[model samples]
Target: MRPPFPTPTAEDIRLVSAQLGRLARDVIGIPARCVCGAPTVVATAPRLADGTPFPTLYYLTHPAATAAISELEATQVMNEFSQVLAEDEAMQAAYLLAHETYIADRESILLVPELEGISAGGMPVRVKCLHALAGHSLSVGPGINPIGDLALARCSWTPTVCQCLVYDA
Candidate 1:
């Protein structure tokens, strides 16, 4: 059977490693890409080969994108987003739904009992990691993950523009 997402080519993995400055692990597919076709988000296995239950399904791999999101996180924007989630019932419901969607997407690949109900980036209650949330937004597109969408909007990096040294495989 075919995978749910596009399997990464060897060069895609190499680009991700260069972007991360380390080897990318258990990346089953490239779920999101830049307009120039470089991988923006990688779909990883729910459980690693080492028997670890990995909760992060959509991982941001673009260097510029990750760096921008990291800078945003350093600004303590999550506190403000958490406040929004707290004040807006619609935002809370949408975030909760995003959490559920993330879980379902992961379990569609592999069901890891240990990571049950644990979605990345502090979803359903608060915002924590903009990188992870933005990765999700990039993977699934806008409207699904509101905080992720907001993070993407606030960050300087954009997948619409090619910001990589090498985007072609």
Candidate 2:
């Protein structure tokens, strides 16, 4: 089983800020990291401190992974994944399980009524954002998110590679 979330450090906030080009809000933990120690995926709170509902729990914060998923999105890979979800029963089951897992993970942190039952990446029904799916995959690991796994497989970037941390200065 995966470990619990790690507390975000000062360096984490700095790196996340750099990666996002703005301040990251309600970051609960660094669930996924790169080979060079940079955060690849962050688990965020379901509700922001300002009383806004933030539904996305696992956010992709690494510049390289985000860029790779963005490139995949530009090619309309989501449509292909949606088609696969429609055609395969087993895959659909797994995807639904993935959706359930995402919800449970978020609820484990805090149950935000506004964000209830809403998982990111168009889960259980469609493949909307590869970035979110891939972020989920990176946070949880392989076999949990098949669409995310496939997206990572098709992308140029991999967590095994340490490419982005060099620019962390």
Model 2, 94-144: lDDT tens per residue?
999999999998888888998878999999899998899999999899999
Error of 2 at 19 (Å): 0.8
Q: Return the TM-score for each candidate structure.
A: 0.94, 0.95
**Which 10 consecutive residues of model 1 have the lowest summed lDDT?**
1-10
Specify the highest-TM-score model's number: 2
Error of model 1, residue 63, in angstroms? 0.7
- Regions of candidate 1 where Cα sits further than 4 Å from its true position: 1-3, 167-169
User: Which pairs clash in model 2?
Assistant: none
The per-model lDDT (C-alpha) reads: 0.87, 0.88
TM-score of 2: 0.95
Each prediction's number of clashing residue pairs: 0, 0
Residue 25 of candidate 1: its Cα lDDT? 84
Model 2: residues >4 Å from true position, as ranges?
1-3, 165-169
